[model samples]
Target: MRLALAQLNPVVGDLRGNAERILAAARSASAEGATLLLTPELSLWGYPPRDLLLQPARLALQSAVLDGLVEQLDGLCSLLVGVALPCDDDRAPGLYNGIALVDQGGWRGVARKQLLPSYDVFDERRYFRPGDGPCLLTLEEGERLGLTICEDLWVEDALQRERLAGPDPIAALVEAKPDLLINLAASPFDPSKPALRRQLAGQAARRLNCPVVYLNQVGGNDELVFDGSSLVVAPDGSTLLELPACREAVQVWDSSGPQQATAPLSQTPCREELLLRALVLGVRDYAGKCGFQRALLGLSGGIDSALVAVIAAAALGPENISALLMPSPWSSSGSINDATALANRLNIKTHTLPIQGLMQGFDTSLTPALGQQPQGVTAENLQSRIRGTLLMAVANQQGQLLLTTGNKSELAVGYCTLYGDMNGGLAVIGDLYKTSVFALCDWIDSPEARNCREDLGLPQQGELVGEAIRRKPPSAELRPDQKDSDSLPDYSELDPLLKGLIQERTTPQALVAAGHDIPLVERVQRLLQRAEFKRRQAAPLLKVSPQAFGSGWRLPIAAGGLCSAGPD
Candidate 1:
């Protein structure tokens, strides 16, 4: 039997639209002689429908959408569609994250998701009741098919540092002797996730002694970006087929059909290349889904903004991207020149808005209240706020989505000002550390990024980020001769410490034991905790790392039991 994987991108709450997307993929797969089409988990309503699942009206609409599919998909092919199954009994959470088998006869709930992930960006447990046990769907031809949803296949204790406690769906399926195991997912992108997913599928395939197909949803939903690197693994743990990442695809596989020369497995791109594509996809979907045709950013000639400019050009075409050069009096001529040069290279439109006058005016207005001019950090922040206000005004007038260019390091330490440089609808690289920003910029200027650039519809020739921007010392240019190092540790040192504290969740004492300076570690820890208010108010950033500040990091703004002192 030919099995098809329909990797789709669905908009949350758009039941009709999502159902149509499923049918389109189903029709295309049936045309290619596929007998069964498998879609990602919750493909009908999109993943993490969140509060939308609570509305009785939308749940009722879900039923109507499924009915439409039953009629339109008749005689085409049997399909396994992910859905929310409503229970009639008085279960606290009335819905089960489920899969349905739809064919000429009708549709029925076949397999429900056993593991409902609650950690990080997922809150599935809030809306779903876990399935009771393993599910086995027997086809008309008496072919037994084992079924599971996203987290069901992620039971490997060794691969993951922590495993979800639940019934082992794969283990239960071992005695069922199924011909195939299919796991539907809406797994978001993390640099380590692709390989980890493949390994998980391979292990399940070997355990079941049958082919395992893992289909994942692709595209950006809010802050989460899913890279659909779906795959099929043979019983021997070798990959039989692998789909492309960061896009939608539908392809069929037949083991009984004539054997052709097996193609080499596709290699995952370098970290920089993967990140660029993921971010571009994130930005593109975020803007398109939010009804923004153009994007605006405050281009400071700094590495962060320069990289965002390149990404914006790639995501929403160069013609649709606009940059505002809000240079203060202290801004260097070289910085201004660099910003203009970078914009010219990417073919994005740029407008200069000198904020020197605005800075003086603010000082004049505030002097009467304080009986003195706003000085030091107060003065520096005024410059940022002036630029932010101008960017917001332009974005509003032009109907462009404002993109924030702050990196993770600055954000982690509260180095950025509130309602100032941190202002935007989306933070493009808020998960990327300042050091990673430099590395990505360097890669953008290198030959390796050329092909990815061309594929992303960006300019492929010459240096995209340029050497001057890449080599310049990191600075906000808020004050004369001001550098980031003046206020914070060097990125080379700070980023690792930040990563340890944020991603690794290392204690200050543990960090100190690991050779980070005790005083610096404690200071960084305090800054990170104190900056929670700012992060809480910041824009939703594109999540590239496993732990980003948005939705996922649920630290309290007003709590502290921070550990003190270095390791003995």
Candidate 2:
């Protein structure tokens, strides 16, 4: 059987548009003489349709769209489209996340997703009831295809720790002795997930003694960015073909043909490249889907803002990206010059709106109310708020999307000001640590990032983020000669601790035992817990890590017991 995998991007809740996209892929596959075409999970409704799946009208519309697909694909080719099947048994969570087979005759649900993941950015169990049995689709050519959805194939305990308890779909498929196994997925990017996926597919292929096809959806859907690094693994546990990552692709594989040459396992790009692509895709899709043609950010000539500007330029074209240099009285000439030089390199427009006047004005207004001028943190935050207000006003006036530049480090400890530095429509790199911000900047300046820069349509030559901007000490520039170190631990020491506390969920005592300072660890833990409210109110950050502070991090804001119970 000639099988084609459609790694296409889908807009959430746009059933008709998604169906059309599926049809276009089907046409391309049919031209290649493919007998069957496989699409990603929830391709019609898009992944994480959320409450849209709860709507009665959208469910009815799904049926109509499927009917249209049946007619549209008639005699062309058999297409397996991912959809949410309505349950007739009147069950709670009245749908089954399933695959529908559409051909010349008609369309019907062929394979239902076995595992319903509820953790981390996914709430499938809220809407979908798990399928009870193994799904095997026997086609006209007598090709027995074992089918599963995204989370069904993630049963390996070695690769994942907190796995969902369910019947092993691969084990059930082994009993059926299927000719091929195909997993339709909407797996999001997590830096290391691509390699892990390949390994999982290889393991499953070896177990089933058949070629395994892993097809995934690609694009940004709110906080989640799907990296479509789809692949076909041979029975001997070797990858035959691997599709491109972070982009849409469609390729056909002939099962009857001779075994193709094994793709090298080590050809994967560096961590920096993968992360950069994911962020770029996230920003591009978020802005495009939200109907913003231009993007705006406060470029303070600091590392965080500078990196955001680079990504914004790459994602929304340099012409579409605009930066507002909102310098306070504390802002240095070197910082202003650096911001301007970086903007000039990227060809992005910039407007200097010095906020010294705004700061003085706020001080004047608050002095009578407070009986003195706001000093220290309050004064610093006033400067940020002024810049944020200016950026928002310009964004509203010019109809541009405002991108927040605060890194994960800032957001984690409440170093960022609420409605100030944290104000924006999307947090592009809010998942990146302050250290990661510097690392990515260094990579952009290095020669290794040249080809990747060219591919991203960024300035392909010479120091995109100049050494001056990158080498400068990390500072908010809200106060005179104020460094981030004055408020928080050095990023070199802090990010690792933050990673342990936030991502690894390590306790302060454990972190201290692991050689971190007890005082620093305890202080950081307290800050992390207390800053939950701020993170809750911050812009939706792009998720590139396994555990992000987005929808996945579900800690309570007012849990005094949890906060007080920290290490003594």
Candidate 3:
């Protein structure tokens, strides 16, 4: 049997549009002489449709959409479409995250997801009830197929220790001894996930002693980005085919074919390149899906905004991106010139809106209300607000999506200004640490990034970010002679500390014992906790790392459990 894998991008809650996407892929697959078509998890409503699954109107529309799919697939081919199945029992969760097989005859539920992950960004338990056991579908030719959803195939106790209590779906399915196993997944992207998924699939294929097909969703939805590296693993645990990462693709696999040697996984791009592609895809999908053709950002000539500009130009065409240089009284000439140079290199439009006048006006107006002029951090924040207001005005006037330019390190320590520099529809690099920002910029300017830049439609020639911007000392330029180092520790030192605290969940003493200064660790810890309020109000940021400040990093702003010195 020839099976077509539809690694597609779906818009959440757009039942009509998502159904149309599936139908289009099915027609193409049918033309390619494929007998069966497989789609990712929840392709009809998009993955993690969240509360949309609970809406009465959406529940009512589900049946109509399924009927439409059946009509489209009639006489063309058999399609396994991921959809939400409403339960008849009122005591149940009211729905099952399930797959329905639609053939020329009719459609019916074939399988439902058994393992509902509640950890991290996933809240599946809130919407879906677990399936009882393995579901086997028999074709007209007497070919038996075993079906599983995203988490069903992930039964590795060592890898998923928290989920060990759940019944092993793969083991249960293996007992049925079907000819083939197919998994529909909407797994989100993490740098380490692709390799981990490959290991899991190989293990499953070996255990079942049958060919395994894994179909994954591709696209960015809000903060999550899904990399669709769909694949077909032979019965001997050899990979016959591997789809492209961070892209939408379709490929056909023959179940009768001999088991081929596994392809080398070394061909996967290095960590930096993979991350760049993910971010670019995230920005593109978020902007396009949210209905923004154009994007704009405040260009400070510093590394953060420069990197965001490059990403924006690559995501939306350079012509579609605009940069506003809102220099304040303290802004340096070199900073302004550097910003202009970077914009010129990227071929993006730029407008100068010096904020010195706005700063003075604000000082005069607020003198009476404050009984004195705003100074120190307040004064510095006022400058950021002025620049932010101008960026917003330009973005609003031109109907462009504004991109925020803050990084993880600053955000962790509360170094960013809320509603001021934090104003944006999307935080493009909020998941990257300040040190990572520098490293990425360095790589972008180097020879290694040529192919990636060209592939992404960025300037492939010469240095795109340039040496001047990359070499300049990091500064916000909100005040004269100001540097990030004035208030915060060097990023090289701070980034590792933040990683230990945020990602590793290490305590103060533990960090100190690992060679960090006690006072500095405690101070940084306090800043991170105090800054939760600011992060709470910040724009939705693209998540690239294992632990990002958005959705996954759940912490209460008012809560207090500050680490203190111990007997050590």
Candidate 4:
């Protein structure tokens, strides 16, 4: 059987657009002589529609669109498209995330999602009811195939800390022992997941002794970027076919013969390459979806702005990426040159607007009766606020989206300014740490840049070495001789402390007892809890970790009993 995996990107709630794309893929697959085409789970409505699943009107609209799809495509090929199905079961109108097999003639069979994953990014329990069984559907090759949606096969492990009904779907399906196993899914992107998905499927197929086809969705959705490295695994535990991550593709696999080696995909791009692509798509989709074109970023010579500039260039063409270098007296000459060098490397336009005059103007304007009693860091902060104001003015004039570059580690310790550096339409790497940011930049400048696909073009930071900047002490340079280390512990020390506190959910006293400095731990914990108010108002963050500081990790801002609380 020749199968086609429709690894495409879908826009959530764009019913017409999603349906049109799926129909187009079906026609394309037919041209390739593929008998059956499997699309990602929830391909019609887009995965994890969240609360949109609640409205009865919306589900009705989705069903109407599905009917239209069946009405339109009758002869091209068969499509196994995923969507939600409504039940009149009186036991609470159950909605199942299921797949509909529609041939040229009409609807074939509907297979509901048996496993409702309710962990991490998923809240299936809040919305969907679990499906009871699987389906053996007819394929053009005269084969009865077993069908399972994403979470169905991922049921080997307990969905929660608690256990549930039935054995793993894949194991149970092997007993029914259809000729082939077709799994539709919308597995999201994690940097480590592409390889893990390939390896997991290879092992599963080798154990099952049957060809396993996995289909995954690709594209950016709000806070998530789905890499569509969809795969086909042979029964002998080998990857027969693979598609590039974050790209839309229709991967074809023939299930009859022993797999032959074709051109292997380029090695996973360096960390910089991964970050660059992720950010580009992140910015592009965020702006494009929210209905904007141009993006404006404040370009300080510092690494954060430089990285955001690179990301903006890749996202909205160089012409669309505009930068304003608002340097204050504290800003160094090297910083200006670095920003200029970065703009040149990216081929984007740059504007140098000195903020010294602006800073003085603000200082003079505020000198009515405000005395300088506690004249320490607050005095230096005025310069940052002035720069931020200048950047906002330029952004407003050009009608561009402002991009803020403050990172996760800094934000964790209240190291950033609220109305100052925290202004932007999106916080690109707000969830990333300082160390990972530099590592990603190194990947971009390495020899591997030559191997990246020409279509998805990356940002080049030029022959202007990435390491010097990488190693140069991380500093805001807001004040003369100011460095990040002056106020906070080294990130080598702080990030691990943060991981222990946030990821491990450790308490302050417990953390100090476990090798953290008592004073530092107490200060860090207080700052973390106090900063909840700032984080609550911050822009949505891109989630790369199991836990993030934004909506993914919500804690109380004023509640005293946050530790091991019942309902955060």
Candidate 5:
């Protein structure tokens, strides 16, 4: 059988649009003489449609959308489209995450997702009820096809510690002894997930003793970015073909033909390149879906803003990006020059809005009300607020989306000001640690990134983030000669500490035992706890890490049980 995989992006809740995407792909596949087409899971309603699945009207629309897809597939190739099937039993949850087979005139359910994940970013058990057994589809050519959803094939993988307790879907399918195995998925992007997926598919192929076709979704939906690295693996656990990552693509594989030599399956991109592509895709989709044509950010000439400017320029065209040099009285001349030079390199427009005047005006107006001039942290935050307000006014007047430039290290310990540097419609790098911010910049300047940068249409020659800006000490420029290290621990020491606490969920004693300083670990713990309120109000950050500060990190603002070093 000639099968085509439609690795396309889908907008959540846009049933008609999603169906149109599927139909368009089906027509192309049919033109190419493909007998069957496979789509990503939840292609009709999009992945993690979340609460949208709860609406009665949406369920009604889904039925109509399915009927339309049946009509559209008439006289064309057979299609396996992902959808949510309503439950016939009242005792079960209202829906079953399933795939429908649409041939010439009719469609029927081929397989329901057996494994419903409930850990990390997934909460499938809240809405979907597991299927009781395996599903096998028989094609007109008399070939048996074993169907599985995203998590159904993940049970045997030891890396996924949060496996469901239901019957092993892969084991059940193996018992049926199908000729070919297929998995439809909407797996989100993580730097290491693609390799892990390849391993899982190889294991499944070896167990089933048949070629496995894996199709994954590609796009950014809310906090998730799906990297559609679909693959076809031979029964001997060798990859026959692997699709591109972080983009939409369609390709065909002839099961009857000889194995084709393609790129090495085990090769993965450098961590820096993988992360950069994910961020670019996330920014483009978020801005485009939110209906913003242009993006603007306060360019402080620091590492964070420079990196964000680079990503924004790449995501939205450089012409569609604008930067504001909101220099305070404490801002250095080198800072302004560095920002301007970077902006020139990226071919983006820049506006110089010195906030010293606004700073003085605000101090004068607030002195009488408070009986004292705002000083220290208050004064520092005032400068940030002035800059944020100016950027917001410009963004509002010009109808551009504002991007915040705070990184994970600063955000973890309350180093960022709320409604100031933290003010923006989207936080592009809020999940990146300060150390990661510097490393990514270094990678961008290195020869390894030249081809990737050029492919993304970013400035290819020389350094995109100049040497001067990168080598300088990290500072906010809100106060005179203020260094980040003067207030917080050095990022080299702090990033791992934060990672242990936040990502690893390590207690203070455990971190201290792991070579972190006792006093520093305790202080960092207190700071992280105190900063929960600030992070609560910050912009929605793009989640790249396994444990991002957004939806996954759910800590209470008023909690007092801090991670302790010992019996205090």
Candidate 6:
């Protein structure tokens, strides 16, 4: 039997459109003589449809789409499509994430996801009802194929492992001796996730001595983006066909013989490449899915904005990106020149809107009420707000979306000006740190970025032509002669401290005690705790790490903690 695994990127809630995409893939696979075409979990309504499942009308609409799918794609191939179905004897008559085995023979089998993931980014316990029975359906050829949704395969509890782990998917499939062990998954992207998944599939296939085909969804859905790195592992545990993560690939597997390994686990790109690809896809999907062709941002001549500009150019075309250089009295000549050089090098449209007059007007009106110069943080924030206002104006007029350019480091410390640089529809690098941001930029500027630029034919050959953005010390440039290191410890010093205080899972007092410099640690720790409110208000960032704000890490809004050297 020839089976096809269709790794798709479907927009959430677009039932008709998603069905069309699925049908097209099925047709393409069947033309090549594939008998069965398996799709990722929840391909019709998209995975983790979240609260949309709560609405009966929405589920009914999805049900209508699923019914149409059963009619439309039957004769082409035996299709296994995932969708939300009303549960049998459910407590509230709610829905379950289910798969329908459909063919010209009509729908033959259904399998609800058994293990609903509740940790990390998944909250499936709030919605789905687990299936009680193990499904082993007989195909037209009188061969049985075991069916299981994503989380069901990974489930292992102490009690279950001890008592009934014998009915594991691979073990059960081996016992039943099915023609193929096909799974439907809606896996999200983590830097290390795909490797573990590939290893597990390869190991399981070898142990069961049967071919295993896994299908995963691709594309960004709100806060989570599914990277489709679908592949087939032969019965011998060798990878016959492999598709890289973050792209759409539909691969056919021959169940008759063993195949050679074309690529090993080592083919996965480096972290820099992984992150660059992720951001590019994130920006592309966010902009394209949101129906915006263009993006605008205030380029402050710093590495953060410059890196964001490069990503925007990669995501949207260089021509579709708009760069604005807003200078105030505090703006330096070096900054103005750097901003212009970077914009010109990128080939993006640029405009200069000096905020001197605007700042003056606001200052004059508020002088009497304040009776003092707008100095320090307030004054610096005013400049940022002015630039943000101008950028939003351009965005409104030109029908473009504003992209926020702050990195996680600054967001962690509340260094960014709220409602100013933070005013945008999406945060490109909000989940990345100041350090990782630089590394990604360097990779983009490397010879590799030139050779393997996106399919759009954007010229990355010159590769970040200007040296200023690369060499300049990172800074907000909100105040005259200001540098980030002056206010906080050097990134080399502060990053590890921040990581210990947050990322490394160390306690505040322990972090101070672990140390090289206690005062700096305390200062950094204090900023981290106080910055909670700021981080709370910030937009959702694409999380590259295991822990990022609003997802893995959740802290209290109130200042309530125990430590002499508190999360200061």
TM-score of each: 0.98, 0.98, 0.97, 0.91, 0.97, 0.92
Task: Give a tens-digit lDDT track for model 1, residues 406-479.
Answer: 99999999999998999999999999998899888888888988888889988888898888988899999877
Runs of candidate 5 with Cα error greater than 4 angstroms are 259-267
The count of backbone overlaps in candidate 6 is 1
Q: Worst ten-residue run, lDDT, model 6?
A: 158-167
Candidate 4 lDDT over residue span 1-568, tens digit each: 7788899788888877899999999889888888778889889888768888888788778867877888987677678888887765756537878888876566633788777777567787777777777566766568867788876655434222233465566776766777777778887665766666666666667656777788898877877777777888777757777777777898667777666446674566555566567677777877887777998888777777777776777688888888888877777788788788778777789888887777677667666757532246676767667667777887788788888889888888778887788877788888788777777666666766645524455543244335555556778887788898998888888887787777677776677667777777867777787888888777776666656775557577786743431112
Please write out the lDDT profile of model 2 over residues 425-515, one tens digit for every residue: 9999999999999998999999999999999999788999999988999988777788989989999999999999888887677787788
Error of 2 at 329 (Å): 1.1
Against the true structure, candidate 1 reaches a TM-score of 0.98
- Pairs of residues at least 3 apart in sequence or in different chains that clash in candidate 2: none
Query: Model 6 compared with the native: what TM-score?
Result: 0.92
lDDT of 5 at 380: 92
Clashes (candidate 1): 0
Q: Ranking by lDDT, best first?
A: 2, 1, 5, 3, 6, 4
Q: How does residue 552 of candidate 2 score in lDDT?
A: 95
Taking the tens digit of each residue's C-alpha lDDT, what string does model 3 give over 362-447?
99999999999998899999988887888888889889999999999989999999879999999999999988888888898889
- For each candidate, the alpha-carbon lDDT, in order, equals 0.90, 0.91, 0.88, 0.74, 0.89, 0.77
Candidate 4 lDDT trough over 10 residues, lowest sum: 155-164
| lDDT for position 445 in model 5 | 96
**Alpha-carbon RMSD of each model:** 1.2, 1.4, 1.7, 3.5, 1.5, 3.3
Per-residue alpha-carbon lDDT of model 6 for 457-521, expressed as tens digits?
Answer: 55756767356677888877777778898787777777777777666667667866776466666
Candidate 2 residue spans exceeding 4 A from truth = 262-266, 562-568
* Candidate 4: clashing pairs of residues: 74-104, 272-440
